[model samples]
Target: MADEHRNEHAAPHHITPLTTYIFVFVARAAGTLLTWFASTVDLGWMNTPIALVIATTKAALVILTWVVVIGSFVWLGVLFVLTFADYLTRFWAIY
Candidate 1:
């Protein structure tokens, strides 16, 4: 039965081209530089959202490049949960 199942299903294979890897690396580096530059600018209320957008884009790129699509979604779900938890606990004035 095991042999039959193995024969029925082919092994998973993924081959990313070198250029794709190089592009991802460059994009990540650019995202880092952009994040740093955003910190220097005084956008006041816009700063946090801008930073979050940049960070999310970088994370999505990494997740999609290195992991399966489903894995990316799972990771994003976990991040959302963590962010929500942090938001919920922020106003805790338990003195």
Candidate 2:
């Protein structure tokens, strides 16, 4: 029985090609460049979200796994919610 499940633990995975790695690296580099460009141009309320999206994409590429992708979105959502939550509390006067 253990041997039957052994293959499940050590399942054969797809091997990644060098060119595929190079492409992902290029994509990550492009994401960084786009982030810089976005920073330079003021997009008003649109800047943070766009930057977060680019950063998350780059982060996802670092591992290129579904777990990383899901985690990235969760991370993004946390940051976005916290930022807006703080933004929403900037006007209190109860001293």
User: What tens digits encode model 1's per-residue C-alpha lDDT throughout 1-95?
Assistant: 65655754677778989998999999989999999999999999999999999998998887878888796688888999999999888877864
lDDT of 2 at 56: 78
Task: After superposing candidate 2 on the true structure, give the runs of residues whose Cα lies further than 4 Å from its correct spot.
Answer: 1-10, 63-95
Q: After superposition, how far is residue 30 of candidate 2 from its true place, in Å?
A: 0.5
Judge candidate 2 at residue 92 and give its lDDT. Answer: 68
Error of 2 at 49 (Å): 0.5
What digit string (tens of lDDT, one per residue) describes model 2 on residues 1-95? 65664655575767677887788889988999999999999999999999999997887776563344677779878999999998888776753
Off by over 4 Å in 1: 1-9, 75-91
- RMSD (Cα, Å) of model 1: 4.6
Against the true structure, candidate 2 reaches a TM-score of 0.54
Relative to the true structure, candidate 2 has a C-alpha RMSD (angstroms) of 5.8
Task: Report the CA-based lDDT of candidate 1 relative to the real structure.
Answer: 0.89
